[model samples]
Target: MSFINYATREIQLKIVYYGCGLCGKTTNLQVIHEMLADESKGKLTSLATNQDRTLFFDFMPLVAEAIKGFSTKFQMYTVPGQVMYNLTRRLVLKGVDGVVFTADSQWDKMEENVESFNNLIENLSLQGDSIDKVPYVIQYNKMDLPSVAPVNYLEFLLNNRGVRHPSIIASAKTGEGVLETLNLVTRLVLNNFIKTQTGRSPAEKKNLVLM
Candidate 1:
């Protein structure tokens, strides 16, 4: 979650990118690292398997000036997509402030996507977090591919599984929808952060943070 320091007037948050194997989770981070101004981002650390799939995680820290004397920073991460790395994935998600689920849109990976999504929920539970209560977003990746699952179908599955978080259509390779997804999640995470820190009622916090 976002950390708002009344003394320093700073807000720091962790945003995690999660998905199944080869679902473009790492690609999303690469795109951000490339697009952001060098001065705004920090060192990126990545651990990969022999085949180059994510092994541990990819982490990049970004800082942005906030309005009204408040500063905001985000430490972005990508969980290893392979199931063998489940332990690693679980480790990275601890204390995450926000989540972006990058689902592989390819039709053939439908089952894997569903299973991975379920894993996200299970893992979050292990961390003492409820998926319904977290600040999260879904990214349907590889939208440019012809064989990808239909948007409507994916939406239906997500809804049925109680994954009602906001979603974005994206092709990480081309950088489409990347910034929009980030902006949406950042705003939601910040709003949640402010609410928890100030101890505002849910409705009051929602209204104030959205403003």
Candidate 2:
């Protein structure tokens, strides 16, 4: 759920990036944090192991355009992806409004990708949140790697859900598709909020869509 502060005229949405260990979830956040103007982003905070793998989560707060009279802020997070950190992953997902599932594209990591996705479903269910209802986008990352799987194959493996959510092919290291993935998820989250709060149709709220 999104937090709305009328007195402060602000709205904060939480977006979590989830995937297997070393799947570029942190890289996506790092790229966004570095590219964005300092005024538009908060300090990038990371709790990582000595080897630099995320131990808990990476947090980056970003300010977007105002919606109605409220300033829209997105608190971006990346869950620790190692299997042993399942508890930490669930804790990070407590109140996410949107998600970006970053899948490792290397062929060797296919099984890990599927396992992490199943873990995601289980955690969301435990929190009483259905994956189908959440605003999310799948990102096949590490595309620049030579051993990456084909996009079509990855889609069948990870995105063959009842409804196909938006998916993007990305190389987080090179910054490809990072912003596109972020923009799409953010739009979905805002659109959902508009529909629920105002009972407005897509046509009625078309103008408010982020470009």
Candidate 3:
């Protein structure tokens, strides 16, 4: 859910990057933080272990186009991908406006990906949200790897559901498809917000896209 502050003319949205351990979730945030200008983004903060694995989450706030004349600020977060951190993952997902599921494309990580995805569904259910209703995107990360699963296979495994979402082929380390993934998810979230605020479809709100 997005928080609108009328007094300050600001709107805040939370977007969480989720996936199994070593699926490049942190890498995605790192790439995005590097690509954004300092003036447009806040510090990239991470709680990681000695081995540099995410211990809890990585957070970075980014300023994007305004909505309804209010500045839109997106707080991007990456949850700890380790299976044992499931509780931390659910906590981070408490008020998510959007999500980007980063899947490890390596063939051997398929089981991990499936388990993480199932965990995501269960966690959302616990939070009183439905996976079908969330504005989300899937990212098949590490596309540059030689022994990765085919895009079709990944899609079939992850998105064979009632509503398939926008999916991207990404190499977070190389910055391939990273911005596109963010842009699409941001757009999806903004469209949903616009619909809720204006009681009209996004296409009917041309001014919403203008800023």
Candidate 4:
């Protein structure tokens, strides 16, 4: 659900990054935070363990494009990638307007990728929300790794949801495909919001691509 502040003419939406530990969820945010202008983005805050892996979430708020005279602000977050932090993950997923599923591309991480994706679906269902109903994108991260699996195999493992989502191949360390993934998901979130507010058919939604 979006938070609309009528007095301020602002709309706040949440977008979460989810995946197994070391899948580059944190990398995505860190890269994005570095790329964004200080005027456009808020503090990039994270709660992590001594080793620096995400323990709770990474949160950053940014002002995006406007919608119908309302300022569009996005609350970006990343849930802890550890399976033991499922409770924290569920809490971060509450009222998410969009999601970015960052899958580790290394062949050895395939199983964890699939498991984490399933965890995402289960967590969403526990909140009375379905994956089909949410705006999300898949990011095959760590593509620069020599041991990475092929994109097709990775797609089969994570995107077999019957409804294919926009997926990106990225090397978070290299800053490749990070913003593209973000832009696509934000576009989906904005389109979903517009559709619900105006009752527009999928095809009728405007193509408002974010840079």
In angstroms, give how far residue 200 of model 2 lies from its true place: 3.5
lDDT of 3 by residue, 1-211 (tens): 8899989889999999999999999999899988988888999999999999999899999997656588999999999999999999999999999999999999999999999999999999999999987889999999999999999999999999987889999999999999999999999989888787789877876766786
- Provide the lDDT at 186 for model 1: 85
Q: Name the regions of candidate 2 deviating beyond 4 angstroms.
A: 204-211
Residue 6 accuracy (lDDT) in model 1: 86
Residue 27, candidate 2: Cα error in Å is 0.5
For candidate 2, the 10 contiguous residues with the lowest summed lDDT are 202-211
Order the candidates by lDDT, highest first — what do you get? 2, 3, 4, 1
Candidate with the larger lDDT of 1 and 2: 2
- Model 2 lDDT tens row, 4-85: 9999989999999999999999999999997888888999999999999999999999998857788999999999999999
Provide the global lDDT of candidate 4 against the true structure. 0.92
Backbone clashes in model 4, listed as residue pairs: none
Residue 1 displacement (Å), model 4: 1.0
Residue 130, model 4, lDDT: 92
The true-versus-predicted C-alpha distance at residue 168 of model 2, in Å, is 0.6
Model 3's TM-score against the true structure: 0.95
The lDDT for every candidate, in the order shown, is 0.86, 0.93, 0.93, 0.92
